[model samples]
Each structure stands twice: as C-alpha cells, then as structure tokens.
Target: MNSFEQLKEEAVRLDAADTLAPMRGEYLFPQHDGKDVLYFTGNSLGLQPKGVKQALLQECDDWARFGVEGHMLAERPWLSYHEQFAAPSARLVGALPHEVVVMNQLTVNLHLLLTTFYRPAGKRNKILFEQKPFPSDQYAFESHAQLHGLDPAEVLVELPYSEGRTYHTTEDIERAIEGMGDELALVCFGGVNYFTGQLFDMQRITAAAHAVGAYAGFDLAHAAGNALLHLHDWKVDFACWCSYKYLNSGPGGVSGIYIYEEHTRNASLPRLAGWWGHDKASRFQMKNGFVPIPTAESWQLSNAPIMSMAVHRVALDLFDRVGMAALRAKSEQLTDFLQRVLMTVRTETGWALEVLTPSDPAARGCQLSVVLPGKDRSFVKVLAEAGVVVDWREPNVIRLAPVPMYNRFMDVLELGQLLARFAE
Candidate 1:
C-alpha cells in the first residue's frame, strides 16, 4: 500500500479501538456536499450538542407555563439556577465548588475579578501579562490601569518570548516575574494563548507571582475545556472563561469564573456588587448594605441568564459524565496524530509549513497553529469549500483543533491528504 493508504488504514484501526469514539455521534456537524465536513475548529466554536434544542425548549415551556412564578416553580428553579453549575464547573477546572461561579461573559468576569484582586498598593502597581493575549484581555488590563489613575504603558508589563522563539518557556516566564519584583501587582495570562495555542504553566507562574508578592490570574478563554487545569491546587488567585468555545455552549454563551476559596471567604474584599450577590436569606429584605455571598457567587452583579445558561448546563453535564481525565487522554493522542499527519503532508508535498504551537504536548492543547507561507484567506476559503472546516487567524495562520469529544482519527488523516493535494 502507498503511504497515504497506510495512514488511512491506521486511522481506521485507531477509530475502531477508541473508547471515546461513540462521542462523535453526540454533536451536530456542519454538512457539505451531503456529508459531515472535516471539522477542526472546536477551539474557536465547538459543535452544537444535539441536546441543546431540547434543553432550550424545556426552558421555554417552563416560562410559558409559569410566567414570573417560574423563578421558583420551574423544573429547575430559576431562582437558584446558577447553583447547578457550581460542582460541575469546579470539577472541570479542579477547583472547590465555592470557588467557582457561572456568571457574565468572559471579559466581564475578568473585570469583576480584577476589581477584587488587582489592588495596586504603593510600589506594587504594575500588571504583568504575556504578550499577544486575546485582545479583550489586553484592553481590560489597559483600562484597569487607567481606572487606577496610572499610565497603562508603565503599569502594564507585557512579557515577551525569549529571543527567536514563538512561545515562552516556563523558565523565562518565571525570570520575568521575578524581575518585576514588587512593582507587579498582578500577573495575568491567557492560560493558553489564543493565537499560538501555547499552554502556559499556570502552577509555576502562580508560584512565581506569589514569590514576588503579586496576585496571579488567567483568562482561560482558550484553555478552559481545552487544557487540564487545577486552579485551587495551583493556588491561582482568579480565572474566567467563556463557555462557547471548547465547552460546546452556543455563541455568546454564559461565562464562568474561579476565585480561590481564601479570596471568596474575604467578606471585606472590594467588588462591584449587585442584588443577586447579596446573602440569600436576607437578599429579598431589600437591605441597603451589600452582604456578599461567601463564595465566588459574591462577584456576580446580576441574575443568571437562564436561557444561555441552560445550554451551558448541558455542556457542563457532558464534561461531568466523561470527566477531564478521560477527555485529556484522548486529546493528547488526537493532537499528536494531527502533528504526525502534518509532518507527512510536509514530507510528501515539500510545502514549507511551520507549526507555531509548542512541540511538547504538555506545553500545548489540541489546537495546532500552523503558518503556511504565502497562504491566506483564499486558501482557507478553498479548504472550506472542499468540506473541511478550520479557523483562519490574521496574517497567515490556520488553526486546527481535532476535538477529542467529537473528532475522529480519520478526520486527521483526510485533512493530511487534502493538504498534500492542495499545497503548491
């Protein structure tokens, strides 16, 4: 058999033996030419769970039946709706239940967490973050510095990668944090970089920041469902992630946050409060003082968006049933197979492709960011037309994520064949 045929046979064998292979049937894939497209963009937006529609319809039925009384009388009472997510979300991120809370969108939650943790005092007034984080995080950091009447240019420190490298080394990150010393008020990073798909060492980074007397946090937009996290054990001060990406909630889905339990228990900590964050027993008393709930729920500024959260609940439940350990094991193998396929394409086609994501499996997630020299949106469009779905970042990067929850080994093999056929 030819090399391509051998690869195809290998993929078929792998698929047949995969324990998680049955999960691919649970999602609704985009159709192209009367077949499921080779989808590899779960890092951007996950496939819709088949149960989402029924879940939303159930919520609608509850609303139609109960009107305002639905807050208490619905099948899943709207009054305590957000509570349902606590344990599952905590499990997803390796945090205590009290440290996790489903709340506003990703950026909004980051701002709220910053209000409590980014306290600039005396010499410690600067915020340190890795370079090229998601743009929203950069904006939040800048605005927070401005809010504190400090110049962002000085108060925000963007840690650059080591010379001639596309990603940061853990050692370099730790050295930079140490260099910042007392000037660093907070060290925040995207747990996995959105553009490069590089996973930072959250535990080591958190420890480095603490040694320098700075609070540590992360924007887990690309890392939440994509990487294995342990925020509580890592002693991470705060984190926030949107549910729409790898979590498989729909677009503009509800976001969740993790605040270390110690911070959650600090009643005197400053926050932008709302009625929903008040003590449950006395919340309806319409009291003036804000008595923050002694959990991460204290940061919430409004009631849960039940409709959006209903979708989130379904996605989180799936994670609970499958568990991160099982998902991560599959993720590592799938991503590794994708890398080998890309290597084969380069060898056969002689295409000058560079994978910008880390070669080390532990330093990255399922997403692989490839730089195809001279290829642009036109190439991406061609691939899309040919029944392969992927994400294109600006400049010349094409990001592919073979999500373990739904993607198959054959999908990776076919993608390799397509690249070899299309490359000039």
Candidate 2:
C-alpha cells in the first residue's frame, strides 16, 4: 500500500513537475474545511477562468454606459457580439466560422437541428442513438419523434453494447447503422459518453451514417473543448454543444451549432424560422417573407444574449491564446498519470475500481469514470468529505475530470490518495 505521507509527498513532486501548473491560478479553486478541494467535476461544470469576471463586468458597464445604444456603441458592440466568439469557437471545433453559430441551449439546439435534419418518410424515419444517452437527449428525441406522428418506440432506436459494457464500440454502432439500413433518418450520439467518457469515432460514425443514407449528428455537450474535434472535415451533418463545461464559459452560457457547408446554402432544407435567422440586410426590413441567412446563422431563433456572449468571448479568447494542442498534450499526460496512480490503489486494496473510460488516451478525454465495487454513492460521499469534488452518476460510476487548462497534476494525485484512503 502507498503510504499516506508518501502520496502527499508525491503529489507535491507532481505539482512541481507540471508544465501547466501555473495555469491553475487562472481559475478559482474551491476550498472547504481549511483545505483546497480536489475539484474533478469539470465534465459537469468547469472552473471559471479569472477573466470571465472582467468580461461580464465589461458588459454590465457597457449596459450602464450606453443603455439602449449598447447594441451599437458598447466597447465590443453587442450587435456583433456573437460574431466575436465565432473565430475561436470555430477553431475549437475545427470548422469555418460560417459553418458554426452560437445560440440557444443544448436541448433547444438539438430540437432545432432535428427540425432541419430529421425528415421522416415512409421508410427512412428512424433516429438511432446510443442506449443510456443523457436523459435530456433521450427526452428530446422521443418528443421530436412524437411530433411527426410516429410512435417513439417505432422511430427511436437505442443501440446497446453487444458486450454489455459501459461503452459501445465503433463496431457495435456501425452494425446498428447497417441493420437500420435505409430506414434510419438520423444517427446521433454523444461525441463522448457522459457516463463513461468514451470518445466515439466521429469520422467512422459519420461515414457509416451517410453510407446508410442517414443524417449524422453529435451532441457535444461533454465532448466540446474536452476533446479535439474536426466536425467539418468529418462531414458531420450537424452538431450541438454547451460551452459551460470544458469551454469554461460559465453557467448557462451560449451553446454552439454546426451545419455542414453543404447544408448551409440548401435553401430547400427545412428549419423552424424566426426573425433573427433572416438575412442581416433584410432582417430589419420588416418584410413579410423570411429570407434565411446563407450560413449557419440561419439557425438562430432569437436575438443574441449579449451577457452570455461576453462570457463566451472571454472563454474563446483563452482557448485561442493557449491553443488546443498544448492543452490536449497536458490533458493526455495528466490523465495518464491519474489513471496510473489510481490503478496502483486498486491493486493494493484488491478493489474492483476499474476505470470505465478507455485505457487508450486517444479513445477518451481528461475525464476518468471510475466504477467502484459497491454502493458508489457512499464512496462519493466519502470522497466529498475528504475534500474531493468528484461527481456521482447512478448505479456505480464516479466521474473525475482533470481539466488540463486549470487542473493541476497534484490535484489528480490528491484525488487518487483520497479515494484510496476512503476505501481503506
């Protein structure tokens, strides 16, 4: 067994060795009981970047200074606020700015994308998703299917892993596509499963969906910013993501959506319309007809929320400055170190604390989903009391995300020790 003092000493050494250690000061880490909490919940809610406060304050000051004219006169010009976030946001997802837009919430964006992509006909009407999809997504898909006069059970197909594991492999997903054949209207799943942190093969999945004559989409709420994505190059039909997690855009920040360039100019593509989606030139013309914008902007359902947009802008700026490659490098090393240390604990205690996340770093992200032997809830509470802030999902999983931008290597070390001590 690793000595408690030895673990603490090793944590200090790892912290000293971390190349990204200095960046931890850029975020506000929570403290409790006179100890800094080992925060591992970035997959649920990211630690706030220090700059977010100044960004939000700038908006408040703009509102105070310009009042009604803030839309045009504010420092950042609220009218073009969403556009300011586009470049960095596009880079984060490997898309052209015109292919991406920030608007609405995650589920709302999903519904809107479904409106454009889920065209059910006589045979090609089913939407296939992974079994145990996030509850919100399951609800959205079911409700959307019902709206088109199709029974949810008949139109919504959930593909479970043949091996009965926490994650569904690419082979299993591709088989589902082949089985569904021409009947599938859309194949959408989480880019990274929220419960297992399993990063699906987007390129392969998209190809399979297209081969089967189905639309390909991804819910990236847990994947965006946590993992590197090339959505446009992958020829994904559409994708939606919330910015509050690894994007560090604060709670309820603006979500992003991507529509492939092929779909961008397709005037025939059906979408639920709104004034904000009209072409900018004709938006205020107050004309009777809705002239959709030529780009992904056409998907917007309402005017931009400048407050949320400001937060997004700050987060994107940070990403642009730090760059994804550098963050991902640290992410791989940090998570690898974490898994190694945690495995040691499992070996010492003979605990069935298997990591649900894939062992291959390329097939996962910074998040590690630890599956405990018994009542995971009690284990979660013990970790909580030990000053670790990991999150618990139902059944037996506890997710701990060591976000690269702000989480220190020592944080991961502390987490492993805390859990090991709890098990003892």
Candidate 3:
C-alpha cells in the first residue's frame, strides 16, 4: 500500500511527465491564507482562464475604437461573434461546425429547442426523462407538455433508477423508451447526472430513442466540456449546454446548441424568430418574411453578447489547443489516482467515505461524488476551512471534480489526505 507521502511523490512524478501539466497555469487559482487553494469544484464552476482578462480587455478596446462600426471593424466582429465559437465548440462536442451555434443561457435555449422538437399531437405526445432531472429541465419539460394542452402526467415518462442501483443503466433507459413506444415524442436527459456525476452513454441512449421514433436530445449542462461527445454521429436530434461549468467561461456565460445539419434544411420547422436569427443578407432590409438560415444559427433569437462571449472564445481556444481526447486521458488518470488514494486511505485508516461515481472509468467524467453517510454535514465546512473547494449536494454528498485542464495529480493527492484527516 502506498503511504500518503508515497502518494504525493507518485503524483509529483506523474505530473512532471504529463504533457498537459502546463495547462494548470492557464487558469487563475484562488489563494487561501497565501496558499493556492485546493479547488475541486470545476463541475460547478471552473476557474477562469488567465487569458480571460486579455480577451475581455480586447472587447473593451474594440468597442472604444470603432463605436457602432465595431460590428464590422472589431478584431472578432460583434455581429459575427457567436459564429467564432462554431468550430471550437463543435470540436469540443464532436459536432459539425454548421450544427453548433453559441447562443442564450441553458434553460432559455432548452425552451427554444423544445419548441422546435417537442410536438405533442394526438396519441404520439409523451416525453421521457430522468425522474430527478435538473429543476429547470423538469419545469421546461412539464411546461412543454402543458403548452400543447396535454396533461403533464399523461405526456411525461419519468424513468426511475432500480431500487438497488446507484444510477440509471443503458438497459433501463432503453426499456423505458421501448415500453413507451410510439407514444414517446421525445427522450431527453441531463448528459451527465448532476448530483451523482455519472456520465450517460449518449450514443446508446440516442440510438434507443430513435428506435422508438422519439427525438433524442440532451441538456448537456454537466457533460459538454466534461465528456468526449459525438452528437452528430450519435444522431442526437438536438442538444444545448451552458459554457460556465467545465468550459470555464465565467458565471452566466453564453451557451451553445447542436442541431443535426440535416434538420437545419427543414425551413418548415417552427421556431421563435428575432432580427438576429433572420437571414444576414436580407436581415438589414427589415423585410417581413422570416428567411431561416440553413444552420443552427436559425434557432438563435438574439445577437451574441460580446464581453461574455469574448471570455468563452479564449476558453474554447484552450480546448482547441490541448484537444478533448488528451484531456479525457488525463481526466481518467487523475480520477483513478484519486480513487486509489481514497481506497488506500480507507484501507490504512478505515475511513469509510463512499465513492458514488462509477468505478468504471468509461462510465464517468471528471467529477467524483463522495459521501460520508451518517457523519456530520459540517464535513464540507471543514473541507472549505482547509482550503479544499468542493460542491455539496443535498443530504450528504461532496462532489469533487479534478479537472484535467487545470487540476494536477497533486490536487487530488492533497484532497485525499484532507478527506482522510477529516474522517479522523
């Protein structure tokens, strides 16, 4: 068994050899008592990239120099600002550039996309989702059901976990969709379970949803920048995500959506329209006819927000530099290192905190959900006092995400020690 010191030394060696280790400096860290805080809450909100300040300053300078003409003259023109995210965000999500567009916040985009995808008429009008989806999604789905004058109870299929299982299985979701059959109009899920930190099999789930002729979409709030996605290949009908979390775009940053390129050609699909979403060529003509753009840009209701999107542009550029596959490799290694350290600490000291994230690395992302059941909830406070930043969920779960982009093997090592000491 590796002693705590041995684990620290191992971490040092591993990080020293890691090609992605230099990325830790790309993000700004908070210091507590003149020490770099052991931050593990990237799943909730990532540390800002050090380059974000420069990106924001450039936006300010461009506006100052060009005034209203900045739309055409700025470094990244304000008018086409959202377009800049298409390629990088597409790479991050494993989507086609034309299929992705950066736009409104999470729930707002969810509502907009649902309006296009969720059409409940006659017997074919039920939507399937997790029993415990994010609150916003629950409201959005329920409201979508009600909007068509359909009963939420009759039109919603709430898939529950098996009594003994920690999370939903692929078979469980497939069975639900098959059971619902033609009545299911849409199948949506949080791409990753928020509280449990479980990454769902989007490909399998989407295929299953398609088998039943139901539209497959995901609220990728937790999964977007955290997992390696292939939305286009997976045949996901639609999906949306907020960039503020693992994407490190700052709080309340701009969000993006993926609509399969095939669907973009359907000009008959109903969408809420605005001046910005109108065709760029005829848009300035202020004509009455709504000419839809042949891309995900058609779904956008407003122009991009420059300052916030400027921050996102820099962050996405980082993902482009290091690439998601390399990041996923490092994420798996870091989480494995943390889990092993926790297990070793348990073996040596008998600390019984449970790891709720799946042991199979393929089934999870960067976050590891840990629980000290029946212990004082004040454990989170103790961790915070010790400069360990983590997310606390209801009842008693500490969500620690050792993000590969900025988190080191050393961060998880320190966290393991803090957890062991906290248990004592």
Candidate 4:
C-alpha cells in the first residue's frame, strides 16, 4: 500500500483479492458503448440488483390473484408488508426491530419527526444543523421553525467549519452543541454529508445534545448503506433515510425511519397519527378512539406502497447476506484506492485536484469529493463521455463514489487513465 502502483495489473490483482468482489455480479450494470459503464454514483443512486424485477413481479401477480384477500392470503401479506422491513432495516442502521419502520419519503418523515421532537419553548427553541445541509433538509428545518412561530434567522443555528477548511471536525460539532447549550432544541445533521461525504460523529453528537436536554436526529439519505451505524446503541433520538441510494431500491424508493426505544414505547409521546398507525387489534372495530401502536410504526400516516416495498425487500435481503461490517471494510479500501488513483492523475497532469473529503477512514465512507477549482469544469463532461457515471456539484467538484457493492478496482484504474489522457 505504501508503494501504490497505478498499473492496470495492480488493480486487477487488488480486485482478485477483494473478498466481496463476486457480489458485484448480483447487480445489473447498464451497458455503454458495448461495455458496462464504470458507475461511481452509488452515493447518488445505486445500480439495481437483478433480483428486483422478479420480486416486484411477484407482488403484482399476488395482487392480481388475490384481489382484496392478498392482505392476509398472499405471500408476505400486504396488510403487514411494512413489518417485513423492520428487522433488516434495523440491522442496516443498528436499531432494534421495534425501533425501525419503512414509511413515507425522506422529507415527509423528517417533517413528521420534527413535529414530534422539535418542540420549542422560550429560549430553548433553536434547531442546530450543518450549514450546507441537503436542500430538502434545509427547507424542512426552516419550515418547521416557521410552523412553531419561531424566526429561522433567530432560532436556526447553522454550524460552519473553521475558515479555509472543507468539513466540520467532530470537535467542531460537539463544541457547537456545547456553545448552543440550553438554547439548542434539536441537533440534526445528515449522518453522511451529501456533498463532502464526511461522516459525522453521530453518537458523540447525540450524547452532547442529550447532555443539554436537546433532541438529536439525522437525515441519513447518504449514510444508510454507505456507512456503518449503531443508532440504537448511539441512543440517537430519531433518524430517517431513503432506500434509493446505497440501498438501491430504484428511483423514488420508499424511505425508512428509526425512533429510539424510549420514544417508541412512550405512549405519552405525541405524533400525528392515521389509520395505518392505529392498533391492529381494534383497527376494524369502527371505533373513533385513536390507539397508536407502541412502536416506530405509530408515526405511519398511510398504508405501505406494496410495489416499492417489494423492491426494497430484495435490497434488504442482500444487506442481510452481506453484512454491514463486511461492506464497510471493502468500502474503506475501495475509496482509498480511488484517492490514490486521483492523486496519481494529479501528479501526471500537474493540476491541483484537491479532495475535500476527510482522509481518515473513520471520518468518511466510499465517496471522495474532488475539487477542481481552476481546471476546466468540462472534465466532468469528458468523464461522462467516456462512460463513467459520477456526479458534479456547482462551482466545480466531481463526486465519485466507488461503491463496494459493484464497482471494481479496474474501474478506478481506468478512470485515472482517462483523466491523465484528458489532461493532455
């Protein structure tokens, strides 16, 4: 590793030794120019596994065959379809089965969770979050503040990194919470930053917020399958994630939420409820009294979208087979390999392509955010023309995520070669 080589032979050798390499075959890679495109955008949207179509078709067939009776008679029982995700989704985020539920989209769940947790009182009414949060989260934070009759400018605390730095240090976040003190109503952050790919210290941040009697939550849109999480052990107040990224459940896939055990079992906790959240025992009794389930499902506003959940079930099955620990191990190596590849290109091109994401493995996942400030932004177009699927941020940054799920070491090598040639 010290004498990192840029040869294709070396990449092939590395891939040969990667224990999780064979799992790549499980996914369906899109063809480009008579070959598979080198996909490095799992952080944006993951490639679909081959199993998804069959699972979706099975759900459709059952729905057609059983009419209304599929709720109880068909495979996986439509009435309790959301229950199937509890255990596997819990494992993905390190929560107990009762603590997790798959329902609604990411932003909707965020609003629902905020309504329950972000109860602002006089003085202790501020919401603290990252400065550059994903646009949806930023909107949710501001809207929730407005709903509570609090001015966002006055009550929303945006945590910024030190000057000239790209990401907030764990100490910066912890200190920011301490600085907010009694005024911090909630501490919300994207578990893995969408742009920087910097993994925040969720557990420490939760502990710091709790010390000041503030709620701690996360929008885990990028963190869900991209990083190893122990939300239950971390004692995080609540969290939510979409399954379309690293989980690979297709575009606009169903999202999931996790409520801490303390909150789930607490009947006193107030939440906006609906028929789906009503207790199953007396659900059909024609009773008016709303009885919320003593679990995360209590937040459900509607029934499960069976088709979306069916595809999600297939993705979760893969997670169960290939554990998060194994995935994280490969992810670190894959990302590190990419960093080296990019560095080699930088050396060859004499261009200052800076990686803004943290170098420490503990502080990141599979993504590497490369900033090409003075270079031609057209390099992204060139990479795209060459059939490498990566993402670009405005003002010049190309985000490449070498997903451990399907990306190969050879892909990284080829990308470096492409960049080196493009520079010429």
Candidate 5:
C-alpha cells in the first residue's frame, strides 16, 4: 500500500511489455529456492548461455574422436579454429576481422601491446592513465614501465577527477594529455571503469592522444561485450578485453586484442614473437627466423587454447545473432528504466544517490554507479540478502548493471524497492 509497492507493480507491467524479455530464457540464471534471483552483477561475471555447454562438448568430442587429427579433421577445424571466431568477435567490437585476434588473457595481451606501442624515449617516457583504473591494468602498466628501466612512480601519470566530482570529465582528460603531451608515451585507460562504471570518451581521448603524438590504447575489460565500440574507426592503436565479464565465456577465458590494420602491418613495430606469429606458408617449413604474418594474427604468441576459444566462439556467435544495434537499444532502455526508478526512490526518501556514470547514453554502457551518501557497506549487504546481486565497492558504492539481453525491467523495479526499504 506504499509507493514501493506501486513501483513494483509498475515494473511488472513494464516487464509484460518488454520485447527482449524472452531473451532471459537464453541464459542459465542462478536461482534460490524456486525463484530466479534478481541478478544485476553481469558487469563482473555474466551468466552463461544455455548453448555454451553444448558448444564446449562438441569440441571435447572432436578431441576425443580425432585426437591430433582434430587440427584439420575436426568439424570446426582446429587448424584455423580462431578464424571461425574472428569475424563475429571483430564485428562485436567494431573492427575488421583481420585487425582482431583472440589470444591470451587480458593482462597478457596488454603486456604484448605495450611491447609494440609503449615506445618510451628520453623525454617521452611517461605513460598516462585515469585515476582508479582496475588493479590489473595498473599492474601491467607498472611492470611494463619497470621492464623499460623507468620508475612507475615517476613515469606513470594518473589523471585526477574534475572539480567537485567523483568522475573525470572529457575536458579534464584532454587537458591532462595536453599538459603531458611532450613527455607522454602512451595514453591508456579503461573504456568503462570497473568500480565507478564511468565510460570515458574514447574517441576524444584517442584524438587528443594522437594530437600530442602519443599512442592511445584501451583496457576494455569492462567495456567489451557490455557496450558497442569502433576501435578501428576510432583509430585506437591497441585494445584488450577479457571474455569472462560482459562476454560471458566463463572464468579466465581467452581474451582478445585489437591492433588496427595500420598497426597490424606496421613492420617497424617491435613485438615479442613465437611460432604462432610466424607466416603460415613457412610455419611448418621449420624455418628459424621469425617471419611475422601481416595481420593481427601475427601478434599471437601461442596456439589458441581450445576450451577457452570454444566458449568465446559460442558467446560471440550469440552476440552476432542478436547484433550490437539491437542489444544497445535494449541496453539504453533497461539502464534508463533503472536510473529513473532509482532517482524516484532517492527523491521520495530524501536519500542522496550519486550516479558516477555519465548521463549521456553515448558516454556510458549498461552500468550505473550508485554512491549512497552516508551509508555503510552493510546497506549493500541488506540488498544482497533480499536476493539482489549488485557489486559493492569499498566506502559506500554499489554498482548495478541490467544487462541488455538477460535483465528485466521488473528486476530493476524490485531492486529499487529493496533499496527504498533499506533506506527506511
């Protein structure tokens, strides 16, 4: 008989009208008792598609029946296995198939790209990244700098937040690039911040980095499969992402990397090579010298891990079938619905909710970082106990993402009602 009940009822009505609601059946949602938990933590680890197990089993069958012959004789053809995935994966990330390669984990690909693009020199040895980057990226950059005999403390620059704000503005990021232009070697940041869920201005950041002659890269662990991207058109020098998050390929799955066609063919760029990067023509010729392939495939260092690639291939195929445009349309609607109801709760309860993600749909993905004013971490615990799954960062921040394909408008409504109760 309260506003919370009214909101829940409205959400149920909206769910009945949602066209993408059926897509929820496509995933293997975790359940408690006899009901589906209102899951909103896909930004951390996405729920698996029902078909993934079948796809993975096919690969296992191929290996069992054919053994070593699976390389050329398997149904999916393990010899050129990654090729099967390249096109759809590239399509999802807005790159040409030749410009994208499925390779090692996210951090490893980052290290490899750093080898090629983080070309440090006398005055230009400094690397720039946003403040509060995910810990993995910070470690990769720091170690890469150390490998080049530079102190990360001195050579790595972390851009601070804007005036009276928790998130950095485009102008602030661009200004930092300009100030450090002369000394900047690489400009890199998360496409969508892991904790704050703030999506940076990739196009503007790329242009600004190039304006100062610095190479631009993105650690897209949180962005890939969560939002649409155009790395090739954006002229991003390199980018990397994990498959486990938005991509939903299971834990520690093979990650992907993008090196625009220009860099793919850049003969002068330094790379750490292995046999997998060797020319296919001479690959089996037992050649000694490394003759790199001309595409992003040349960046690969080892044979593709079949299990990881199988999972990603299935996930990518699903994305291809659904298509980014359709997914993004649903994403905007879902997140907009979440933002609206949460804002209403804040207004009614006199609770201050800080949304750190950009207001512009163009600048954010599915996530909205909700910073609860003067609330303890226990507040998040209460929501979790109420069967809501939102990620909590230290110091009173909760991140909720209503994934486009699987989350329902009703799920968003239910979470808001629970938070309103906790606020009381």
Candidate 6:
C-alpha cells in the first residue's frame, strides 16, 4: 500500500529476526491508554529492569531481620556491597577491577577525581573540554578553578565544533589539544555528548592529551553501556558516570568511577579522603592517618548506599549477561534504521527536519538530536500528548534514543509514521 505501510512491514520483519529482540521483555515501560508508550529517552533515563523490585525487596527484608548487624549480615553484605560492582563495571568500561569503584553521584565523583587530577601549576593551569558540556560539568570546571584560586574563564578552554557541524571531529579535537600544548593540565570530555549524541574517540583523544603532557579523563554519563569502551587499554587517566541513564539503575542511582591502575597505586596522590577509603585492615580501627586503599576504592568518601545500590546490582547483572558487544551491535543497527525512517519522513512530507547528530554510527550512540522546522515546541507537546517519551533541549532540539536493551524496530517505524502525520 503506502510507504508508511511498507515501512511497517519491514520493521516487523526486522523485529522477528533481531537476536536481542527478546530483551524487550526484561524492562518495564510507562503506559498510556492501557498500552506501552513509544519510549525513546533512554539517554536521559533508561527503563527500569523488571527484576529491580525483587532485588530491592531482598535488601529491605535483610534490613528488617537484622538492624545494625545487617552491615555484615545482609544477603549482599553492606560491608563489601560496592565490591560486587568492580568486576562488572570494569567489564563495561574495559578496565581492570582495581580501576573501578561504585560510589557517589556523578558530579560528586567528578569533583573528587578533579581534586586529585586537576592539579594546576604555573602555565599548565588549563582544563580543555568540548563546548556546551552537561551544565553540572561546566559548573564543576568553574568551581574547581575557583577552588584553585584561578579564574574559570582563564582556566577553562572549550573546544568549539566547526561552523556547520554539531559535533567535533577527533582530528579537530586532537589539533586543539596540540594547540593548547603545555598550558593544558587536563583534557576531559564526555565520552558521548548529551546533546548531539556524538561519541568522541576516547583512545585517540587520550593519546593526544598524553602526548602534550596533559592527563585525559571522561564523563561517560551518556557513553557508559551505550558505546563500546576500553578505558584501561586507552589509558584513560580517570572517568565517572551515572547509573540512571543507559545503565538503568533508577532515578538518582549511585554512580561509578575509573582510575588508571598507576594512579590508584600512587599513595601520595592528593584526595579528599574518608574512612571508607582507608585500608580495610585498619579501617574499623578508626586510625588517625588515612591509609587509602590501593585501588579506585581509595576515592570513596563513604560506605555504599544499600537501597540505591540494590537497584544498581540488578542493572549491572543484566549488562554482564548480555554484554556490551551485543548491545552495541544492536544499537548500531537500530540507530541506522531510525535514521533511514527519519529520511523517509522528510522525503514524503517535505519537512525540513535536520538530524543534528553525527551520521556515522561510530561517531554516535543510540540517540539522534533533531532540529525541526521553525524549531517549534508545539510538535514536541503533540508527541508527548500522544504518549511518546522523548527529551527536549532548550532553543530547539528533540533527542530520541532507541535503547538496544528494550526498544524495537517497530518503535522507530511508529515514530516515523507519527512524524509524517503530524507534519501533514
């Protein structure tokens, strides 16, 4: 029949053949009109894992049965609760277990790592990152500069994208790092940009930074679980990410961090220490000197938040089972299909919609940032009213992320059909 109908048939065939298609059943989606909504906001917040409630209840039951002793007696044991995350987290980011630690929220971990890594000296007092980073990161950069008694405007160098592009090229980024030369103390970037969904070349960027004598770090809030990463092999100096987004741990879930093994073993490295980071043998003794754990755990400021971490445990287990390789392979195909569908909508409806995210699959994750004609908010409202869950950024952009974990090919087809209808 019509092109939209043909697209629907193709979607159905693809869904039937998808190896990861059964994973759609593992999550709980928001309902509208007694049906699951067309959800494409996993880049903002992932769908809740179906097992989350049971996992949380287990911890609650343990707490009820054993009060203070639950620290050592709970099913997961609160004393070493965070240790469970190390192996899985390292696998997710491609690092050694000792280089990873589940800890505070994203910004808090960023600040803690900054305390140790953003060491300014003489001319080498600058931090380089992409333009328009997540607001929290921008603020952290400013405040960290202030903490060092330096002006943020002077200390922060934001690498601007080319005039016609929404994302920076790796070559451009490396060139900028070289241009900054000895002035750069650190080169920190979001492994994938939150706005454009651009996945930066972390390995090349890290090498470029090191070549210039600057440390390299990343905020993987959008990259973790969405992209294929190799932090240890890439020699990423440090990194941090939130669990609530791609990792799907729930709202305000505990965050995780990564530090290179060399940095972890540097006993003299500057850090804002807490008892939780003290050596396990002497930690309970409440010793005066802070003998930090010779691992990423040394950056921990407090014991694990059991309730929140329970959700994280369930989420990480899902990733461990399915693995990032499978997830990323599915992500590439799904995102490519979405792009084709968007192009079809544009062709049929004559809509001047601009997809701002990079076209190269390797340069992006699952999300696509689109700029509609007139940059109107009314269409976004229409989509929301129709039970389509997407994210809108200020000025003019709607971000849609069809997460490989649960989203289907049919979802993309439906979105294209809706866009055509609304445009008409």
Against the true structure, whose lDDT is highest?
A: 6
Per-residue lDDT value at 102 in model 2:
96
Candidate 1: pairs in clash: none
CA RMSD of each candidate after superposition:
1.2, 1.9, 1.3, 1.5, 1.9, 1.4
Q: Which lDDT tens digits does candidate 6 get at residues 28-113?
A: 99998998999999988888999999998999899999998999999889999999999999999999999999999999999999
Using TM-score as the yardstick, the better of models 1 and 3 is: 1
TM-score of each: 0.98, 0.95, 0.97, 0.97, 0.96, 0.98
The digit string of per-residue lDDT tens for model 4 on 1-424 reads 3123536677888899988888999999888898999998888888898999999888889989999999998898999999989899999999999999999899999999999999999899999998689999989989999998888999988888899899999898898899889999999999999989899999999999999999999999999998999999999999999999999998999999999998998877878989898898888885897898999999998988999988899988988899999999989988888888888888767777899999999999899998875656677777888898888897888898999888888998888788777664
Query: With candidate 1 superimposed using the best TM-score fit, by how many Å does residue 183's alpha carbon deviate from the native?
Result: 0.6
For residue 342, what is the lDDT in candidate 5?
83
The weakest ten consecutive residues by lDDT in model 5 span: 1-10
Model 2, 234-271: lDDT tens digits are: 99999999999998888888899999998988978999
Which runs of model 3 end up more than 4 angstroms from their true locations?
A: none
- Comparing 1 and 2 on lDDT, the stronger one: 1
Candidate 6 residue pairs that clash? none
Error in Å for residue 309 of model 3: 0.5
- Stretches of candidate 4 above 4 Å error? 1-7, 375-377
Q: By how many angstroms RMSD does model 3 differ from the true structure?
A: 1.3
Report lDDT (Cα) of residue 266, candidate 5: 79
lDDT per residue as tens, model 5, 1-424? 2366676786788778877778788889777666888998888888898989888899999999999999998888887888877788788789999999898898889999999999898999988998899988899889989999989999988888866777888999999999997899999999998877888889899999999999999999989988889999999989999998888889888889999899898767899999999898989998799888999999998988998888888777778878888889889888988888888788778788878877888778999998888777777667767777777888878889999888988888878877777774
For model 1, residues 1-424, the per-residue Cα lDDT tens digits are 2377778888999899899888888889999999999999898889899899999999999999999999999999999999999999999999999999998999999999888888998889999888788889999999988999988988988888888999999999999999989988999999999999999999999999999999999999899888999999999999999999999999999999999999999999999999989999999999799999999998988988999999998888888878889999999988988888888888888898899999999999999999988788899889999999988898999999999999999999999999988986
Q: Rank the candidates by lDDT, best first.
A: 6, 1, 4, 3, 5, 2
Candidate 1, which segments miss by more than 4 Å at Cα? none
TM-score of 2: 0.95
Residue 401 in candidate 1 has what lDDT? 94
Supply every candidate's count of residue pairs whose N, Cα or C atoms clash at under 3 angstroms: 0, 0, 0, 0, 0, 0
> What tens-digit string does per-residue lDDT give for candidate 3 at 4-40?
8889999999999999989888989999899889999
